[model samples]
Target: MDVALQALTVLAAIALGVRTKGLTVGLWGAAGVLVLVWVFGLPPGSVPTSAIFVIFAVVTAAGAMQAAGGIDYLVGIAQRVIRAHPNQVTFIAPYVAWLFATGAGTGFVYYSILPVIYEVAYGNKVRPERPMAIAPTASQMGITSSPVSSAMAIMVGLMAPLGFEITNILSIVLPSTAIAIGAAAFVQNKIGKPLDRDPVYQARLAAGEVTAPEPVDIGVASASAKRSTWIFGTGILLILAFGIFEGLRPVIPGADGPEPLAMTTMIQIIMLIVALVILLWCRTRSADVPRAQVFRSGMSAIIALWGVSWLANTFIAANEDSIVEGLGGIADNAPIFIAVALFIVAALTTSQSSATIAIIPIGITLGLEPWQLTAMWMAVIGLYTFPINGSQLATIELDATGSTRISRFVIYHSFTIGMLVMAVVSVLVGLGIGGIFYG
Candidate 1:
């Protein structure tokens, strides 16, 4: 009865989400599942870690940045770049995708840039679907190995018990970042040209499809006109140095590389602080939004992801054995299956951190190299680049005119196809790659 009720509750949550597209309700669904399983003693673990502190910190940091006018500034800069080079739209698209993925999480990254994407589609007669697909898909590419990503952090934590070393991880997994990025660009070129030829896309561009963007009210930050570009560069250098060393820490025989060396959260905190200091020193202006409003934006961004992640973790924790068995069957012979499974999980959960927490531990038990597991991580990142992501939601709020037309399915499937292509690549080279990593 407990198991049945749990399953029913999970189904209800999913059904509700599908019907309303309400992330909040989906979270409730996860909570219900947790109640059924945890309170009823269905799953094996004692209790899933709430990870509330992590979520709170991420939200606070985001809110602080918004208060400082960071996101508005990003949007302004992105808009200008897109407007300046409509022709390079395909080429520059990845950078735009990467930027959103970096801090905002892939789904929210998709949400944040929707207006820009829609406008670019309108201006260039670009098939918004393909570029839309490309952008979101690209955003997911980062998550598998991004030091800053919460999902990556979760993996770091989950595997900490196993003494997984970061240096060992880098040699095996870091290469995938380059591969994933290249794969996204390659797929975009292949898929994007076809989208351009679609009659609907052509017709829409001919109709002058205008996504009514919110008026840009922010002050312009001269990215080029700054002595502190050097300071900015220095800060970035420091952050990277910190991150690289942190990534290497898991492999160190003893804990002496840098005192408190493993705390990468500190590295990012410092990075954000330095970014602010340099921006101020350079007198870099922010977008027109007030500081308070900016903080609100950041709070929105963080919560956009935080709620979904917390809920999903709760659900997976409740139905873990079932979830694990369902997913684990393919984990070994079906790396591709694991990848696809994560995409759906990410899409359903609408947050990679949640999906990663739900899935990766099971994946590890099913047998994965921490390195190859990294590739699997990329698959999840790609999945969340769907329209359901937070930034995509935020972007929708920007364009009241509804110029952005790709439905949730289109964004999800485009990324799905990208995942398939990567799977194909892995299959073709599976033996070679597998031998190198797992053997």
Candidate 2:
């Protein structure tokens, strides 16, 4: 009875949080923590300080890059590519979107290229939905694979203690997610009616509701833009080098033997250095960094992670024994339940970092192996299962031809099939790769 009541309290807090996004989710989570500690007499859990620092560091670098026009530089390149391969927009557009988000460490970059994608496809008479719907979905998938993303920060923090490295995580996620996007694009290319045959599009065309999309103007990349992008890319490569070849990092004397610097500390230091270099070399004003969209979104993510992770850790710590005993059998007999739980939580939270911080600890407590958890990590992409995501809504609005749309049944929106296919394929592919590594 006590455990059930406590679980109900956690659920209620999550419900309220999901209803009001941004800082409110964190506020509600803090409220839940208050109730749990004061009312239920539950002891507090350790704060996720390491994960928070990682997010702050990575976001700082990404924000600095954005402030220096690095994002614009990348978008210009994407525009050129899309325009160059107008006939293959459906097959090529999602990959470009995925690469942009992956490189920028934020999905907001996808918004810049959406217009280009729509213009290229609509101009070519290709069904706009074919590329428009899946492009944003592919952008979200990139977060799971991004080395500097908030979701990756939380994931690396969680798995590091278990002897896994960032390379291990990326090895499974990058290939799986890339392959998943291709599979989804192939399927999406077949589903929607061709632009000319679609009745709604034709009707809109006849009524003058659809106008020819204006050509996207991709201006030349500035010196600062090019400099910042190169600096940021170098930072990412350095981090990967450190992860892949531990010998590259400095060895510090320890209580036992000299050990290489910790990856978390290395990452924080590297990202901070990257930010400083961008500010100096790119001539970006310090004031502009905080105002960048990546900074704002990343800061908001930190708060949500702080509050929700605290609330969840507290509740789980208080009831760890009960939860493990109750669910351990299922975890052993049917490990897939672990992935399903992650998917459902991600869908409910609608924030990849929030979902990761909240549920991954519970999976750890359930005695699941790190490789097993990593194999299922891509399931967090389920955040797009609902059409309420900003990226999805933006995709719909950007399509002047009205091919990208939300169905009356919200679940049946334009992104559903692509999102579903990507989720299933990524997880399956991740499992296959994980087996080769740790099976």
* CA lDDT scores, all candidates in order: 0.51, 0.89
Give model 1's TM-score versus the native structure. Answer: 0.66
Question: Which is the leading candidate under TM-score?
Answer: 2
Q: What TM-score fits each model?
A: 0.66, 0.98
Q: Could you give candidate 1's per-residue lDDT for residues 46-165 as a string of tens digits?
A: 222323333334334343444344555565666676667876675566567665455443234454456676666556765554555556556665554444454655565555456554
lDDT (10s digit) by residue, model 2, range 1-439 = 9899988988899889999988778889999999999999999877788889988999999899999999999999988888889999988999998998888889998899999999888888899999999999899988988888989988999899898889999999999999999999999999878878999899999999999888878999899999999999999999899999999999999878999988888999999999999999889999999999999999999889888888999999989999999999998998878778888888998988878887788889998888788878888888988989998888888787788998899889899899889988998999899998877
lDDT (Cα) of model 2: 0.89
Could you tell me the TM-score of candidate 2? Answer: 0.98
Q: What lDDT is reached at residue 197 by model 2?
A: 90
